[model samples]
Structure formats: C-alpha cells, structure tokens
Target: MKGEKMMKQNQQDTPLYTGLTRFSQQHPISFHVPGHKNGAIFPELAKNTFRDILSIDMTELTGLDDLHAPTGIIAEAEQLAAAFFAADRTFFLVGGSTVGNLAMILAVCSAGERIIVQRNSHKSIINGLELCGAVPVFIAPEYDQTAGRYTQPSLDTLRQALRKYPDAKGIVLTYPDYFGKAYKMEQMIQLAHTYDIPVLVDEAHGVHFSLGNPFPPSAARLGADMVVQSAHKMAPAMTMTAYLHITGKLVAKDRVAHYLQMLQSSSPSYPLMASLDIARSFLATFSQQDKDKVMTSVKQVRACFGQGNAWQLLPATKLDDPLKLTLHIKQGYTGFQVARYFEQSGIYPELATNTQVLFIHGLQPFGELEQLDNAIKHVNDQLKFVEKHATIEVVNQFPQKLDTLAIPYQQMHLHDIVHVSLHQAVDKVAAEAITPYPPGIPLIMMGERVTVEHIKQIKHLIKQGATFQHPDIINSICIFADE
Candidate 1:
C-alpha cells in the first residue's frame, strides 16, 4: 500500500512498512547481531522482532574487523560462508543483494563490454548497467499472460543468444525467478562455459533453495561462476544479510574483493554481519534436518490443498525454492483478502498480489497447515471483495521481434540519457529502466532506444493497471538519455 501511490514513477518501491523498535542503549543483552547492548526486546520488538531487530548495530569493533576490506572476524565470517556454500570465496553482505549484484557485474566485466543478460533481472542489475556502462544483450524471459507473469528465459533462447552474441564477455542469469520458476541451470551453465563466459547468478530468492527439498539446486553448485543470495529472503536472518559466492574460470579473487569495497559501505553493520555469519553457520549445521522438517510441512500443506476445498496450492520443485508457497485463492477470497485474513490471525504471508499469495516457509517451525486449511475455509465461508478473478487469460505469442541491444546497445552511454513523459519521450534513448515488475524484466534498460512494440507494451502496462517506477524520479515519467 505504501507504493500504491508511487506506481506512476515506473520504478518499484518498498511497501509501507514501519521500522521496528530495538533495544536502546539502556536495554540489556539477549538476541544475535545486536548482541543488544544487553537484552531487551523493545516494546516494538514484540511487533516484529525481525524489524525491531537488535541494538549493538555499529561499525566493526576491534575484534570484528572491517567488512569493506576484511582481515579479521569479517574475513572469517565470509570464509565460513564460502565453506557452507562450497565456493572458493564468499563475501558477506550486510547490505541487500543489490550491492552484491552490482559488485558482481562490475567485477566480471569491464566497462563497455557487453553481457548477455536476462532482461527480467532485478532493478539492481539496471544499476549495474548504469554504473558500469556495460552494454547488455538482453534475453527476455518467457511471458505468461495467464497470471500476467513471466518465467526465466528458456535454455533454447539462452543458447540462441550465446551463439549470436559470441563476444559477450559474460552471462548474467536469474535463478529461481520471482515467482519461483527456476531455469535448467545444468544446461544454461554448460552453454555459458562453452564460450568461456562466467555465469553470474542473481540468486536473491535462491539462498534457501539448496537448503530445502521443494526448491531447485544452487546455481553455484550447478556451475555458475558467481552466485549472490539474500540469506534474509527465505532463510532465517536479518534483512540486508546476503552472500556472494565465486566459482569456475576467470574469477579473480582480488577483483571480487575490490568490488565489495566499491559497493559495500565502509561502516558495515556489525550486528548484520554477525547475523549473516550466524545464519550461514546455522544453514550449514542444520540444512538437512531443517529441510526435512520443511518437506514434511509442505506435504501436510499439499494434503490440505489436495482436499480441493477452496484454494489450490502450486507445489514447486527442488529446482524452485520450496519455502515459497505460491497459491491461487479459491472461491471469493482474493490474495490480498486471504493475506489480510491471515494477518488478522497473526500470520503474514510474504506477498499477496493480483492472483497469487506467496508464503515463505523457513527453518523456523510453524503449524503444518492444520490451522491454515481451516482459516482459508473460514475466509471462503465469509469474506468477499470487489476484486473477482476471472478465468486465466493466455498471452498472445506475438512474432518474436528481431530486437537486440547489439546495434544501439553498444554505442549508448549513461550520461547521454534523459527521462520524460512516456508520450513526450517517443524517439529519445531511455535514461531509466522500463521494465514490468512482478516478473522484474526490463523491456528497455536505462539507455536503450525504445521501439514501437516496446512503447505499446509500456502503454498497455499503464492501461491495464500495472504500476511503473522511475528509479531516479518520484512522479509520472518517460525516460530517454540525451543524444
């Protein structure tokens, strides 16, 4: 609801969420990260411990070592992370995956070099493009009209791209997409390496994949050169706690270190760093046991949905993140309605958008669908809202246009772009990302010249109730870099 008003900006914004109050200097210690000055879950901590967080939120102390250029505790923390993920090196991110994503992109490719990338990647990747001025050979993902969503680009399409853009320095892929649709990593990675291009994976939603059954394998294990995961996404940890992994050919360990400095803050949060270290260590120690418990819970939830009473649960695979429970609301309850109903019951799903309600299962324990099944039935029995979902509409398979950044993409620069009203900005090169959210793929990056079809799609998104956010601006916008 916070960003409901900012949709016109063409950039995605955070939800209206309040910061949780933590233990103040006067409080005592207890939990992790904060080590908490002492231990007092402030009154607000009870609201959302994850939000209220802890005290002890400070820069690296003498024993802690620096995060930007670590040598002590931070280095040990990252080493432990690397061991857990089985990588040559692992950098802990107290910041979100965005910093790591940009760092990875900057580290892997020189400025002006082109990367064969998924157009559906997160907004962070757009920042990578802008910051490094890397020309992108965008691989658009598979669009689904049924749910107004998109899945990862097919292996077939990726191969086609690799074959065509032979000079692309490296490849960037997104594993276990926003909706939990995973790609065939084995195949994609194989294709990327055949050309000696390091595969950088934005596994922001993937940290929990290897730790659970219903989800897919880690892209790093499947052979990507670099992997970035938000440990906070599906794993039990504080927000902004993330991990960066390195593997395969051409990855200079020092370059990785350099970019971490380039993107990460000098004053890294000790508490957050400790949380990431604790989370990784925790994930290593309890991965199987925790995954087994999660698997059991998933089966129980599936049984509840199999009863076919109201809602239908989409059971994802080991190739997708298992904790992500994507469900289609049955009867008269919309996703939001069901989410709100759950919230009223003191439970909150991760997200509730137009047609799906996604609940993130984690290492934590909870009711194994017994309560959820009943609450859903109860909602169906009583709740009704104005948003009624009709039969799924299939997206038209339009002729694949011969669109590639190869032509204009190579020559464009970040400074040569400008933003304007979408209507007024017909022929100018884009200075902002014009991507469809939910699926998180860009039809046009910050410097790509828009085509008629691209413009049509943008207008369609505006007409059909999709919100667009311009990263730099806060109001209605159209973006094109200056000539």
Candidate 2:
C-alpha cells in the first residue's frame, strides 16, 4: 500500500500542474481577467459540477507565470514537454494548431520570402502565408482514389519542389493527413535538410503517435525543424489545446518565442494550459495495458464487420495511424450516406467525405464501441448487394500548381475585393480562400486565379453533401476587382 501510494505521489510531480494544484488549494479571491470570477456567476458551477476545473481557470498571478513570457512554472512545464517529445523546446498553444502554424511560419519564413508548401495544408497555414506575405510554392501531394483523400508527398515530389524552389526559405507539410494517413516524414525531412531548408510539419492529428508505437512515428521525433500537434485531437486534453515543438536549430528558438508572443492570446486560458500539461503528463506515462484495451475495442468493432461488408475500412497498405478508422463506402453509396446511418444509430464520426468516413480514437475508454457494433450491424442489415460499381471517385480536378512565386494580397484593400460566381470568376485573382471544412485546405488561395478545375471540385464536394464555411460564396468566391 505504501509503495503504491509513493508511486502515485511521484507521478503528480509535474511543474505547472503542481503550481496549479497549490494555487487552486489556496482558494484565491476573485479579482482577475475572467468576469465569471471562477464560476461566481453560475451557482451550478460552484455546486461541485465544474468546481475543480473552474477553480483552476485562473490568470497570470504571482507564481502562476504568464504564457507569453514563461519564466517560472510554465517554463518548467514546457521544458518537461520538450523532454517528453524529444524536442529542444515546446510551447503550449491555446488557440490550437492554428496559432502554432502561424507562429511557426512567421518564425521561419520572413515577409516576401518564398516557402514551399503542401497544396493540402490546413487553411491556418495559408492564413500564415497571407499574414507574412510569404510566396508559397505549391507541392502536390499524392492523391488516393480508393480513400478519396490526399496522402503524403512522395520523396520525388519534395525533391522536385526543392529543385524548382531552390531558394525558398523552408517547406511546410501536413503530416498524417486529416484522415490519419501517415506520411513518410523522416525521409522527406532528410531530403529537405539536404537543400538547407527547414521542414515545418502540421501534425495536428498525431499527438498520440508518440504515446504508442502502434501508431506511426511522430513528425516531432522525425527531425522536423518545427512540428505542431493538436493534443486535444487525440490525447486526453481539452479542445483548442495543442503543442508546438521546435526540434532543430534551423529555426531560432527566440524567433519562435517571439512569434508565439505576437500570435497567442495575451490573456491565455490557464485551464487550457493546465489541460495540456495534464494531458502530456498522462500521455508520457500511458500504460501498455491501456493501449491494449484501446486496441481490443478497435478490433472488436472491426470484427463486427465481416468480409463482403458493403463498407470496409480503407486499406492499411502503407504506414497509417491505426487509431483512425477511414471506412470506404462501396457500390454507389457515399460517405455521407454511411455517416448519416451511423448518426441515426448513435455513432458519430470525426469527419466524412464523398467516399469515406473518418473515426478517430484515443486512449480514453471507448464507451461507444458496443453502440458502434450495433450500428454496424444495423447498417449492414440494410445493405443491398448491388451489381453496379461505386462511381463516387472524384474527377481529377486539381488545378495546376503555380509555376511562379505566389502573388501576395497582403497590401490590397478589402474594399477592392469583388464577389463573383464560379464561371464568371474564372481567370480572376481570388481575394479570399475557398475551402471545404472536413479537410480545411484552401482550393483557391488569395491572389491565385480561379480555374474551371477548381470550380468542378467545389461543385462536386457540395453535390456530395459537403458543407463550407462560406456557403454564400461556395457558388462564387471573393476575388480582387479588375485593376
């Protein structure tokens, strides 16, 4: 009993967590940034509902330390995170991977610099490009027709992009794409380093990759100069929590710190930061038994679907994150169709596309597996053995890559922007990004010309029930008015 107690006590020795625990115990009086004053406004909050969580929803007090200039407990917590992830430095992100991408881009690539970027990069990466006025040199990733998603950029693609944009500042890539398709980042990073260009990886879906070897290698451990992981996406962390890791010396540490100060919230959420620390502490020591339990649940659910099932998982041919389930719907059925059925059966998926539905799993107990098993059975019961093949494969509507440095619209006035329909907007420079939400990559970036191919892809996605953030502009896009 004593030994068990001692072991548990030792595990709770994290820096920021320790400080937060001590601070919360003090029961400091309300007098800070949050108007709620630690749930004072909500009586239910004080009635043991979110007492503990709300208690720690604190601000940068004396010993608590500010997130922007972490010199105390926050610094220690970040240091622990760095050691856990094998990074030189780690920064907690309250605005999620979006802010991390912004900070990373701003840190490594200066304004007016050319940076090679994946065509399927998250919209936040594009926002960083817009903010920094960086010229993006696009590298087309390998597209998977079976999975109906974009996979990793091949070594050849990276090599070609590097050769073409030899003077580019660095490369920004999306690792383990939104559907949990793992990329060969180590080889790609090695190749980029050969050209003396740093590699920034948006590993938003791979925070658990480092927790268990059952998953692919984390980009943070694969020699990427900068790596951003949305801890909330897969780990036991709160939503909007993430980590930015600086793994190599190519990017100056001070520059990243500076950008983080400029980009992150001045009044950062202590709850979010504490959640990151707690999540990291939990993942650092995640038991093998827990991993086996998750694996067992996954296998049990997989077993529910037998051979000849209308919906089978995407083939795990290459290195992929086992925890992410991308189920391919066959025989003229769309992913939206399967996803709707799943929802009807009380099963919710992470994301769905025209041909596939994505389900993300984490270390926490999967209480919904039995419900999913029944859902699968229910779905299979309604399946008709149609003789026709599925015609849901999207047409190759990916537009040609920009041959020259991307023209920046950073200096352009917003009043000069004009909204035009897809057909009329062809050949016109886009004034804003038009992206589909499941995988938030911009189809047409600012200052880039809209094409018929882009229009076709947008129409196809909408036809398949895919929604957009700017629905008003889905049929049309905001573009720069004629000069």
The number of the candidate with the highest lDDT is 2
- Evaluated at residue 323, the lDDT of candidate 1 is 59
Compose the digit string of candidate 1's lDDT tens values, residues 124-177. 886787677777777767875433456667788888888888888778888877
Q: How many backbone clashes does candidate 1 have?
A: 31
lDDT tens digits, residue span 76-101, model 2: 88887887787999999999999999
Error of 2 at 340 (Å): 1.2
- Any runs in candidate 2 off by more than 4 Å, and if so which? 1-12, 43-49, 305-309, 381-392, 399-406, 410-415
Q: Please, what is the TM-score per model?
A: 0.77, 0.91
Candidate No. with top TM-score: 2
Badly placed stretches (over 4 Å) of model 1 are 1-55, 143-148, 212-214, 305-311, 329-346, 368-371, 382-402, 405-429, 434-444, 448-475, 481-483
Cα-based lDDT at residue 216, candidate 1: 73
What range of 10 consecutive residues in model 1 has the weakest lDDT sum? Answer: 11-20
